[model samples]
Target: MMPDLPEQKGFLEQEANQFFEESFSGFLIADEKNRIIRSNKRVSAWLGISPEEIKSKKISDILSIGSKIYFETHLSPLLKMQGYFEEILVELNGAAGKRLKILINAKESASKEDGLKLIYYTLVEASDRVQFEQNLQHGKSRAEKELEAERENVILREQLIAVLGHDLRNPLGAISMTVGLLERSIKDERQKKLLQILKRSSYRMNELIGNVMDFARTRLGEGIVISPREIDLKPVLEHVVEELKFLFPDRKITVDIALPEPIHCDADRIAQLASNLLANALTHGNPQSPVSFTASNETNKLELSVANDGEPIPESLQAILFTPFKREGNRPSKNGLGLGLYIADQIAKAHGANLSFTSNEEETRFIFAMEC
Candidate 1:
């Protein structure tokens, strides 16, 4: 000022310079005619130019074609009317043709009083952020394509398995009937014993074929047709337990049904769910230990659980237990293709239910629940 103002003004200027240099975003000062008056080091670095060299240059000279068009059409009009614009994405071209995506924010400076506007701009490079987003989108697209292909493959494979199982059943049925007739016709004890062996083998083959077909039907979404009728679950659970007892005669299994009377659900699908879960428990659980089945009604949902005292599911295998063909630990001496839980899960989901599990060293329980 007219008075001595050198020291105080110098201190303020020094602070401003320090602030500008420390900022990561590029900063520029331009006069009303869009001529650069001053620029920070960040801006000079971004444009691959000396700050002094850019002092008299026009702002449009460094913008890419698209960015220039956008500035002319949208930013200039908005700035003229509003005195500022914020966070507009634009591309800047460097001296050697390097391109950078930048988020630009501009505002008119209040200190300009010569009937000329002084504009201040901040530029933030968004190249890395944009690249990351594109990569994420690409990964998502790839995963979707792979999932579609896998679904198609599963459908084709299941169709073939169903056809093979059907064909095998006819021949196996004839062989069993022929063996029964031979058993009655034979006189020698040894011959009778041999025919008995043939009968047992045929029966075992039939069981394997049946399992394959059942698994295939479930995998290909053709297993059960649900007719949403008012059906009770107590009787279905009892029937499933009885059938499982017959299926695994050697294994000791216990069934406990504790519902508040009649509970409505998709009867056939619910039965299939129960049957699959019990079958899984019987197949994987220790024969000496008892498998437990329980059902109850809670609030607006019906809950069912199948539990077994088996070797604990390993931590590594627990994450993907419901995925098709995912098997863990030592395979049970019983031959299985590892689709029981997978089928149970799908059936539960189709019926608007969720399948979940809990496991420890002593017991493993798989639970399914649906709206009552």
Candidate 2:
């Protein structure tokens, strides 16, 4: 055997080979004149060339258009002037028209025995990352446009409600005043009959005006005040039931007060809530069946359910039942504007209460509950 080499020399060779073979980064070694001397498999694969083909090729010939200019103008000059250079990014074309991003570095070898100065390079693919960034920017732009459009729509709706409410109130006030004066002045039987017709027309107009005002207030975020107090709800439920009984004498309404004691709530709002629920039940419940109103305290909440045996609300319509001005199938002319349930829902929420519903062939219930 030949004389054993020094341990340090053997170790260095092993380290150099390990660095080239195990690295995920593409590496290449070139001579002082920029002629390729050796390259790792990664580098050969990146250029679509075999190790044999890469051995004697010039560095400028192996590089893509962008990388060539950068290496000659910046990397080569720096290595020659400073003896070593660190991480310089460059692009190169790969096999099958692919492009790659690479970091280039160069340094003078520690041993001068071989007349070889090594220029090292590491490559990484950046096309996917670049495309991801571009897509993110595009998505942000689209979301901003949608937000601007939604804001414009809200502003337009508020403006329209304001104009409509103002115009409607003026004519409605005049007609109401005229009807009141005619009721007092008309004395003859025929004139009284005509005055009755005028009064009825004025009443319908007033109802429409009230609906318009309520809708405007809802849109403008007005008319919701919740001041909770300890009050007896039994009297309130009974009063609402009595009022409904008088209003709809043809239909039967029953009030079942399970909680005889007091409960905590905003009394005025709860009264309005009860009235709205009872009215809804009366309007939609079958004439042959009686509308039921039930209230009780359960767990930490005071629960109230107004159920009616009527035509089952379809599954699709249930989602939008609480929406403003949304009505079910056509009914008689006596049905008023669909503001009652929407207002009741708003009032319930303001009091930290939840309003929900369940409907089936046998019964339809609107349930409202508030924590005690």
Clashes of each: 0, 0
lDDT of 1 by residue, 1-372 (tens): 386589989999999898897679888888876788888888888899898899888777779998888888888889888999998888898758889899899998775466667999898989998899899999999999999999899788889999999999998999989998897889999997788678757855765676577678776767644567776678778887886785576887777787765765677767877887887888778788999888888787888999999788878888998887777656554455666677678778777789999989889899998887
Could you give me the TM-score of model 2 versus the true structure? Answer: 0.54
The lDDT of each candidate is: 0.81, 0.77
lDDT of candidate 2?
0.77
**Predicted candidate 1: what Cα RMSD to the true structure?**
7.0
Model 2 residue 56 CA deviation (Å) reads 15
Model 2 RMSD vs true structure: 8.7
Give the least accurate 10-residue stretch of model 2, judged by summed lDDT: 203-212
Instruction: For candidate 2, write residues 91-204 as lDDT tens digits.
Output: 666777776766666776654666545665455555666677789999999999999999889867876866786788788788768867877887899987776667656654
Which candidate has the top score in lDDT?
1
